[model samples]
Target: MIYTELYITEEPSEAMNYHHEVRQVQSASKKKILHETPIRSQDIFKTLPDQQRPIRVVLTYGVAGVGKTFLVQKFTLDWAEGLENQDISAVILLSFRELNLVRNQQYSLLELLIFFHPTLHRVTAEKLIVCKLLFILDGLDESRFLLDFTNSKLVSDVTQKSTISELLSNLIEGNLLPSALIWITSRPAAVHQIAPTCLDRMTEVRGFTDAQKEEYFRRRFRNKELSSRIISHLKTSRSLYIMCGIPVYCWITATVLEHMLTTEESAELPKTLTDMYSHFLLVQTKKKQKYHEGQEMRRIELTRTDREVLLKLGRLAFEHLQKKNILFYQEDLEQCGLDVTEASVYSGVCTEIFKRESVIFQKPVYCFVHLSIQEFLAAIYMFHCYTNRKTEVLQEFFTEDDKGNKISLEDISSLEDFLSRAVEEYLLIPNSHLELFVRFLNGLSMKSNQRLLGGLLGQTESSPEIIQRVINKLKVISCQGKCPDRCINILHCLLENNDLSVLQEMQDFLKSDNKSETELSGIQCSALAYILQMSEEVLDELDLAKYKTSEDGRWRLVPAIVNFRKARLHDVFVFGGSIGSLAIALTANPSHLTELHLSSVSLGEYAEDLFTHLGHPNCRLETLRSVN
Candidate 1:
């Protein structure tokens, strides 16, 4: 496996390399860890303190897809290669997901060792235990075994017969092998399965830092220039860059970029999570086509079959995601119109699109490669049903199955009504996954995306009228809510449509609502910035004091606000928000503002920073006031 020291914590500025300014910003935000010493993956057990009750067990926790498994693999490989942790004679890797299948089977530790490691059959359980051993247990959250320590009898000897869970419990609790080393990996949600005293040290896999993200990309692409370009493009979207913190997402992103850059020049790069994953899905589908003969026939046949598989997979993803399941049994596959054999095929074609693996007794369990993929598939599934005019699918998306199945949009007289109902019925719930669903819905509404989908899923009407209605609905939603971020995202999706109607509508909405104050979310600010940049007319004055915003919102508005010919605030009251935009405007070359007025405003702790910029040499402020 390709390896890099792509994970680190910033202790001193001297210890890292990236960009100086980036390092400074990173160092300032992170607190100093004074007590915890840095431990390498291979040396994790070796560094544990030797005490009366030694720290023989290590618990490593992280969010899903944060490279915990990868780290384990790397560590294990290093040991096997005699590169690190050489003192440990052998390492046994076990997956809880696989372990679940053997929960019903009674086995002694000796028998279990033979099951997972057949080569070790010659060694007796007692001898294997006494030898230098490192046991790695992966994915505690996926395990179905009832690990009830309170009721289970504990045995220190290897010949003791017990259920799979009891075997694991005994191993971790030191009843089976007190001198042996154990490393367990789990998502944060499943960390409580082991008692606090059972493990010695608990470390979290923090994924990648900014510098590490850069390092990974650099290592991933041999073409340094192309890597730089990709990194630059990724940085343009904060949310997209944030997703790259996960190693799997980073790989997915790299996959998308490599496909787009090398394969097609005209193709647009992904800017959002939905777009990125959708592109990834397309890439995965196309990848299968490359191996087959008869390019045209293969493409069509594979595309058609892939679409069918994806639809069923999407339904499965949505249903399981709703149930908060990242892992599912073979029975779950049958429920979603997929048998184990068919799922195995998809697992190969998708290649981490949907994973199929066997558990403890060789019982198959399946899961989407990652949670985000599940969300993406779910979104795609919902849209599939919506486009197909399946009313029950709408109910499924909303998780309101009991509300009846006869529901249809036919009675919703207008497009606006249908959109409003869709938003209210589903998007308003604020499920984290729903955000991606709405984004995909909005993106799939685009004619270009629809064309792309059409190629793979057969033709469907790509209606500009429907797209406009959604844009209009989003604008309405943005102005009506306390946090208008999702609504803003919907509008952002339509930005490439080259339609300024949404922006004009937003401007009109802001201007017309002079009677009351309205706040724009961070995304709303981005939308406003986008509109301002796109607008041809150079206004003499612009004001946003009536609309309260946050630091992120203001920061996004900086470039747009600074370009205005004259910015004004006669009686507008700024809330506890950063005025960084205004400050940046003040410091710009030619500094467009001719006059400024602040009657009553609180610019938070960064108020002085804003004021200091006003005194800059390039400041064009003809008049200024800070009224008490």
Candidate 2:
């Protein structure tokens, strides 16, 4: 709940669904935020002095957990306290999760306001028309109503009765409340629902900047030493550092690290995402057990009833995650055998994994602390299902058509095939919501994580043979995959399994004089590309022809040259189409190549084909050597 300022910009992000964005944003941890204009919460409803019309409807989009909801809440609080937006007479902030529950109900606009806020019951319809009101509708991504802008009935009267969907659509379209300000928040996937013609401005919320991340821990903890230790530990791992952009992730890190630093336990500090989350889960459970059950537990232990609730919650997480449904209802809870009054719903100390939103209505709403937690729980449940021999649950899931491909759950008896197929299924789609979940799944397969959650996960084993198979399957998938995103994900899976063989071989090949002993595979070249791009140091020379790989494998290494000062591409093919690896590097914003040594490589069929990037503003090429 420590509110820090997020990087809000005028330029909207082009990310897909939430988890697809979670994976993609790591690439930007090293790049500059390409926002054309930065804005504050107060500036969202303001019109510029460029002789433009008044900005009425503002559609704000951001990735999940980027602090969109918190920003709006703070904005409302500021307005209520007369600190900002003093001109506005009233600000009514309604949660979309709560609103989604009553999507089918019919109500007058005034009645709708009174339903959510009973204090507004005294304010008559006569007082509403004269006052300047700002209606902040949060979480359009979780909305259930299909807003038919073209077909929904228009209701201009605030007293007129209509479905909630029509009332919102009409209000946004300016038929109901032309003078009132409308502010809506949505994830990138649902931003297209509100057309450009209806919106006057668009804003995107980015996660914590590098400076803001440090400031957050300092603000959260009074002890400077504790904050410094936490920050130092996070910087050691690239994944942990990049993921700190999300405010919730920052909280998760604070919870796990602070517990370890302060406690008397001699557990090793977590280095991976799975390790952090696994420790986090156990920590929360231990606190709950010790407080509620009256006995302090050791390193890691879960009671029988605790394991039952976890598996039930995991089932809920698994079921909704596949449907991309973050928000859950009372029925969702009951379906998973979770009673509203049960100890599992004990909101006192165990709210991190699952909790409910405030509602005086008959129906109760539920959600995990974050999408990542939901994904973590979902991964645990899926693994549980596999280990418990609940093939029916997984079979029902894999039969559906995902994105464009039909995913078949056949011949996946082995642990390697089971995980590889899941990764392959998600990779076929442009934006895989399961990207983070699959990463968790791979990480949970490790002996360390399995030992922590053994009671709940049944008896899933990761023998040396199984681990090698998973690693081998990941490398093979990377070579066959067409999308660079998928190939990068394959590498991530390798990292999750604690297998650094590909990277070690690449380093070995670099150091060895007799490099002919072993040739780098296409996936290994891709892995080398990842290592080069992520490295803090710059390379002086990169000779693609020196490393022995196939023709396609040579192109796979093109992204690595972005770090090189002098790149030697002798007899290399730089062309368009799916083999657009050179295009990927040359168009790189921070390309640092000062000299090029392409002795016999093709520049392209035309000057503007691929070599035109040499004239780009970001390009720093000063020397060219082509003896051919």
Per-model TM-score versus the true fold: 0.66, 0.81
What TM-score would you give candidate 2 relative to the actual structure? 0.81
Q: Report, for every candidate in turn, its global Cα lDDT versus the true structure.
A: 0.62, 0.75
Model 2 lDDT, residue 145, Cα: 74
lDDT, model 2, position 487: 57
lDDT of 2 at 229: 88
Per-residue alpha-carbon lDDT of candidate 1 for residues 1-628, written as tens digits (9 for 90 to 100) = 4332222221111111111121122222232333345566766665444445455888886666777888899998888888888878788988877776676888998888888888888988658766989889998877776577788787788988888988888888888887789988876556767787676677756667778889889999999988998999999875577666677878899998987887765667877665676677767767665543523211223445666777788889878766667788878878888766764445545675877776555676778877778877776676677666666666555443123344445643343444445554443443333444455555655566555554433345557776676666555443222222223444544553334565665577556745236666655665776556435454566555545676545544443554576654434223212223465456533346677666554555657666666556556677776775
Off by over 4 Å in 1: 1-37, 48-53, 149-157, 288-303, 339-344, 347-352, 356-365, 399-438, 455-465, 468-628
Best by TM-score: 2
TM-score of 1: 0.66
Which regions in candidate 2 have their CA more than 4 angstroms from the true location? Answer: 1-15, 33-35, 49-51, 122-127, 291-299, 347-349, 400-410, 478-482, 504-520, 528-628
